[model samples]
Target: MTKRSDFLAANKGLRVARAGFVLLVLPHAAPDAGDIRRFGITVTKKIGNAVVRNRMKRRFRALVREILPEHGLAGHDHVLIGREGGVERDFALLRKELLVALDRARAGKGDPPRGAKGGRGGGKPHHGRGKGPRPAPESPQT
Candidate 1:
């Protein structure tokens, strides 16, 4: 089992690699370091009741165990936070999401760069220019 100290140390050491579904916080550790990377799972009360939360945590742990050896940074600490939907989400989808997040993290110098956006129909700027028409005033309700 992973140790708490390792997670603490990792949090202290490196920047975080994050995605919408998961956040990976990695610290710098040597490839040959004897230290076993640690993992921590956190699911907030907003997710669900104790049972549901526990289930989410378990799923996250399993996913981490399965993917860590292949994608984990040798000397980093990692934490996975489960959203409310995470508990009900399919395992395969979760795995795919995690892997995509990890890949971006790895490729971009251990943390995905900020402002890198992607989504359905492509990412468009959220704000309209000042030239856009203003909204009309609402009429009085009957």
Candidate 2:
């Protein structure tokens, strides 16, 4: 498990954006460092009232605790954003989403391709390399 101080130190690290979520990932640059990772949850007032926000934060914390050991990067700082409907969603779905997002963040930072890009087709998916995917083309059926 990563120490709280380490997480604080990771405050300035990589960041990834997704729908209903924003992942802040800070990779460990120093060699010989231990494989330690910590997670922080941020839910702003815009998300909801105290109860709702707290629930969201709790959910995020739980999700991180469950998945970090397997997928979390060493000496990294991670903050998961809690958006509207986040707290209301199903736990399994949320967990799946969180894992996928984290994987995407890791890969985006250069993990390697899983199967070429999906049908989304914005060229090869450059993990964390550029601005993200381009907007989809509009349909012309009239």
Candidate 3:
């Protein structure tokens, strides 16, 4: 993406988490001329050394090259974030995960998957931090 805000904005869009990577898909508000799809791949240093990171990035690019043309939605921006398993995982499995993630994302089936924390307030009940009615004092017996 041209700006950091664009990548940040994509984070609010649909997300699919696989063992090897996380896919973020955001649909464009207006399809530009040529209807071309754009994509980005990120391999963090935390994943490995420079060599490993580059390898992961290359693998991701190849995967996108093979998959996105026919399967990806035009006017949608796709970002692939590499994870710890990205370099070690089998290529075939990675492909399967990507395809499944894409289908689920488009179908809107994987938004906040099962057992995930609920949205807003971080799934915690708000009780005003122990604020409640005071207990009444004991009355004197007759």
Candidate 4:
């Protein structure tokens, strides 16, 4: 899990959404004999400035430390992505959400509900101002 490849692989795995954050779980296909569960925390700049992001990371790390040992499975990789409200969200609520999300993900119910369409362009495509070039700039007479 120390490698970037592991993180990238985990990105393609199961995703569970919570109010404060999102959890990605990927079971290792061929874990080393000594390999246990591994996890990562990611709080992007979109969440806040450096200070706020760091605080979120610290909080998430603490949450993982407390939750993973009992609830996490061996030979799996989990990555937690902090959401917008994560910085100020209640720790207890976040913990509960994490646990519930994990259970749903394991049960294969974490996926979007039926008839739920995902991604962009689900609606009519925007013409974007007729897709024409801008008018030529008028040259100022010197």
**How badly does each model clash, as a count of residue pairs?**
0, 2, 0, 0
* lDDT winner between candidates 2 and 4: 4
Give each model a TM-score.
0.60, 0.62, 0.76, 0.77
Query: Where is model 3 more than 4 Å wrong at Cα?
Result: 31-34, 113-120, 123-142
Q: What overall lDDT, based on C-alpha atoms, would model 1 receive against the true structure?
A: 0.67
Native-to-model Cα distance after best TM-score fit, residue 138 in candidate 1, in Å: 36
- Which 10 consecutive positions of candidate 3 have the poorest summed lDDT? 113-122
Residue 29 C-alpha lDDT in model 2: 59
Residues 23-51 of candidate 3: C-alpha lDDT, one tens digit per residue? 98888756462567778887778998999
lDDT by residue for model 2 (1-142), tens: 2465655554555556554667777766566557767577778899988998888888888888899889887666677867787877888888887777778777756322333345766665556777767899999999
Q: Please write out the lDDT profile of model 4 over residues 15-42, one tens digit for every residue.
A: 8888799888888867572447789988
Model 2 ranges with Cα > 4 A deviation: 1-12, 28-32, 109-142
Instruction: Give Cα distance to truth, residue 112, candidate 2, Å.
Output: 19
Query: How would you encode candidate 1's per-residue C-alpha lDDT over 1-142 as one tens digit per residue?
Result: 2676655554443344433245656654656655556677878898888998888888888899999888875565667767667877789988888787766556654443344454544465556556677689999999
Candidate ranking (lDDT, best to worst): 4, 3, 2, 1
Give the per-residue Cα lDDT of candidate 2 at 77: 60
Q: Among these predicted structures, which one has the highest TM-score?
A: 4
Cα RMSD of all models vs. native, in order, equals 9.5, 12.5, 3.8, 8.0
